[model samples]
Target chain A: MTTAGQAPGQAQANLIAIPRDWAYDFLLFTHRNPKPCPVLDVLDAGETVSALKQDADVRTHAPRYRIWENGELKAEPENATDYWRDDLVTFLIGCSFTFETALTNAGVPLRHVDQGKNVSMYVTDIQCRPAGRLHGPMVVSMRWIPESLVDMAHKVTALMPSVHGAPVGAGDPRMLGIEDIDAPDFGDAVEHEPGDVPVFWACGVTPQAVLMKSRPPFAITHAPGQMFVTDMPDFAYRVG
Target chain B: MTTAGQAPGQAQANLIAIPRDWAYDFLLFTHRNPKPCPVLDVLDAGETVSALKQDADVRTHAPRYRIWENGELKAEPENATDYWRDDLVTFLIGCSFTFETALTNAGVPLRHVDQGKNVSMYVTDIQCRPAGRLHGPMVVSMRWIPESLVDMAHKVTALMPSVHGAPVGAGDPRMLGIEDIDAPDFGDAVEHEPGDVPVFWACGVTPQAVLMKSRPPFAITHAPGQMFVTDMPDFAYRVG
Candidate 1:
């Protein structure tokens, strides 16, 4: 099931597990490109438990996992325990659910959620600030909001910069290099009704897309729309 | 010269250069302890020119440099070119000046800047989140603000989370392990007059202190009261 709008107040996270040797650069990559990678927690090498939540084992906590070998998709496993290695470091990145909850609470209706479809994600031409060994374009998630409530939506998400922050663009898809609004790079596209303005936010899928380009010898990430919910309050990420 | 009042609009940074071997761990330490180490610019190994500023060299842009070997102070030089190495990775962290300028611009009078003294800083008992090979207690810089204006100071600084953010504590230094308010571990002590409240902020000196404890074989840092000013506008850090 899609994780968006699930566990209202609890924060959900995007998962990225890489070899310990590549953990440092990945951490740097997150810091340098914070809009796309708000770090929730970084489990040390070989750690399976999350410090942010009680009794949550990353190896089997998530509903699904995507394993990669040298930039090639290898398997979509029900659990990552079989793929878990002592030399792996797992990174929990802030997911959009935290902000979607905030948006829903603020009276901003999301078309994707209403249409029962996963949020559309696109790989933009915007290049992320490259770290030592990783470099790739940014990926963004799209939500159709009423034109009248665009400012309100921006204000709400701006308060929670940890969850992809505010919309990167509001009215135009071409500016971000997305040719067709209906053709998303990831997830299913939803219906766009009248007076709806397409809003784009930095997506946690960015690092995953980068991993595909940089070709890390081995890596694992959460399957699309499948997330790990943490006990930490969503308001804990509020900056304003 | 002190950097607190200088560079009214531009941002200032705390410098930390270490062997490339320790750069990854040090980068993680900064990310985990962002309040005390809000990263501004991290120069890749062997890079002397700052990506944030024009024609500024880390080796000579700052007025003074403190060289450390095995956790002990080895030398204080006017320039670091002699000590520079290809394997050295330099990290420029956010300095309090950016926020202090915002505080001043917001009409919050600072006693340290008014009295022409270096801001008093103390080592707190609060431990930083350990990352890889580095961990230590948090250090705090104290600013005495008028009792009624403390809220204004907080509101102003809270907008600049990238530069040490809001105050960690407002009153009672003893709670932070500072027994003698007049005897500061770093910088000069300032007089606390009537209607003044002591506000403490996470300081940039924290990583330097941690270096002393973790004992990295070689490191270089900016001398106290000396800092590098970057061309990046201070308002770029505002969250609201």
Candidate 2:
């Protein structure tokens, strides 16, 4: 179940849980690659509740979960309470969906949402700065914006740097080394309107890509588009 | 000597080198309390070179260094190359002086610089948000700004949150638990102009205050105002 356009003005976050032993490396990783993984909240070991959302419980809040063992997906559970461990450190990363409200409010059309599909996401050739044992290629979410509205979308989202801000690449799909625009590594393929150009923004899934490469003993994360709806307004992180 | 008004437009940073073992906790500490500790760069263990500056060495670049042994000042040396350790992870924090160049360009009168003194800093009753084993009261740098331009000062610095952004408090020292304005916790007191008001901004000297309380086994930081000058312009960190 995608949380796309789920809670209106409220923010949504991608959640990742890892063992306490590997938490430091993960924290350092996010700091080094902030654009793709802007940390919204970090819950210390055994802390079930999120600092960003007081009412949410990490163990059971998200609608779906992906449980991983040594970087291999072992199960897709509805609630992670059964797999929850005392030594897990949870990180809530800012999701691009959190800014959809502002885009919609500003009159920037979202083609994927109109067609009832997930936004397109892909693994890029971009190498993220390494931190300790965590390092991997950056993952980015793609949106097809009209040539006229591209600058407006960029300026609006640039104001909120805490979320994935500004386009990493706005024009060519080949520049980031993605061979085919039709085939995405994650999320759905969407139909584009006339005069639309592909725009890429750094994605929260970059950490999951890192986890796959690093191969921590165990990990858990929200399933695709199954974000934790936060209480913060979209403008809550508006720094400008 | 202070880097104040030195290298007019280039960025200057506060250097803090701590052992690799405690780097995680310190990294988390800065993330939790970002207003005072905006991390510009975190060099891995034994990294004497800064990513922000190509021609600088962390061990010998800063004009002065403070060697801390379990929170006690062991020495104030001219260079830290002698005290450099293979296990040290250096953090370059955003110094407020970085924005002073912009403030000066904006015609904001900085009384401390006018009087040839270090900006006055104070330890406030305001406790910083804690993370792991690191927690302490916030330290603030005060400047006397003309009441008319207070809003302009706020807008200019707010654009650069990486540095201590905007004023924490613009008036009434009593609100921040600063007793006796004439006597400051750090730096020399400055005289205010006719229409000036006491304005406090989050300070780079904050981590030094935290070091006294948390008491890590070993640490190294730049001496007062002896910032390691970087090649990047102040606008490099400007998001808006």
Candidate 3:
């Protein structure tokens, strides 16, 4: 049996099974805010989804759920056993938290996370290498780093190849093909002190635009700002 | 107007454009000793194959050429202009010199190069990831290194992804699924000093075996110990 839950600024607790439609909206919201809402897993239909933690019931895991029909929000369901379906595919996309954690551990400061603001995201002209039905321009989350540590920053982040390694471009925002730095495609802007260059990493929000463009007949994801935590520790990724 | 000429550490004095029938034996000799004979380019019948070096004249550019016919060495021609054909395909493969240069730059000492002996190569049970019409067990060149710095060595070399990055395995020889390390399938075995571990990198010989297996209608490659030295620097592959 599998259980799912979400916690703000912490690990998720409790588990719940919700309607297919609710799963879709929850995933959409999470897609909209991926950094805080990292998706861990989605259960296949006819499969008994249980948390690896093995305590929480997914039947009523998260405190809330939202249902969407034809791209419109339909209902707020506390529990959704009736809405379960025979065919549902789950996804586990990486979150920015992994890299953010890495950056902080390396002593690089992040203003957005410090100020309780969303990391600014920009859709660049650079096209992502597409896979299967998924196709979209890469969306990048920005952070400012001291000029002295720019090279160190690159070396540190490049090690995390799985979760968007290294910045697409540094020094000039225009080189990334972004028109304006202040007016970003998404999220709130932050202060960039002098001698600071903006660094960018591929954002997890990519799948949202991809899904909207791809428009699969059915989908389910975690709600925005609510993420599914997993058993994987960040330390496992470090290469010797 | 890039012309093939004498590359460093190459025993061949000049690049020779030989007739297809005459080049077979030289190609066979190259297959016999692949570490020293990294194939860079092959031009057939002159349909403008451009992957190896820019605008190479298979004939005239190479100072000497050998012509092979039906598993027999027949002629050594200065140029095979009259023997050129449109049916031949060129193969540009990685050279050991590239990886050796990379290792030296990263401070990983090479015993064979330092001792002026051929690097020891072993045939391993590990198989090369096959491509179209190519298949063979991987041949790896061994370099002795300090056991403590093994991790750093893997990291530094792994960055050179195009030129066989990282060791497939380290420490025990049998652990790599190889029964014997002392008696290599090819090349001279070197002495392993105390506190040294044997490190292995994929050798270019893989394609030759693959070619023999595929038995392409016709192919051309650089002679043993002869490589097509390019103007491109080693660092071009480090990042991207």
The better-scoring model by lDDT among 1 and 3 is 1
Where model 2 places Cα greater than 4 Å from the true spot, the runs are: none
Clashing pairs in 1: none
Q: Which digits, one per residue and each the tens of the lDDT, describe model 3 over residues B1-240? A: 111122432222113333334333333333333332333333342444333445665444444444444323455455555656664433345545565665666677766656665566676776654322334566676778888777777887666543455666787888656677777654556777789998877765454444444554444433333344555565653542
lDDT of each: 0.87, 0.88, 0.51
Assess the local accuracy of residue A158 in candidate 2 as a C-alpha lDDT between 0 and 100: 79
| Model 2 chain B poorest 10 in a row by lDDT | B1-10
lDDT of 2 by residue, A123-227 (tens): 999999988878889999999999999998998787777888888999889999899999999889989988999999999988878878888899999886788
Please report the candidate that would top DockQ against the real structure. 2
Model 1 segments beyond 4 Å from truth?
A: none
Query: Which candidate's lDDT is highest?
Result: 2
How close to the true structure is residue A224 of candidate 1, measured as C-alpha lDDT? Answer: 73
Q: Chain A TM-scores, all candidates?
A: 0.97, 0.98, 0.67
Model 2 clash tally? 0
Estimate how well candidate 3 is docked, as a DockQ score: 0.04
For model 2, the DockQ equals 0.65
Per-residue error (Å), model 2, residue A179? 1.8
> Candidate 3 DockQ category?
incorrect
Which has the higher lDDT value, candidate number 2 or candidate number 3? 2
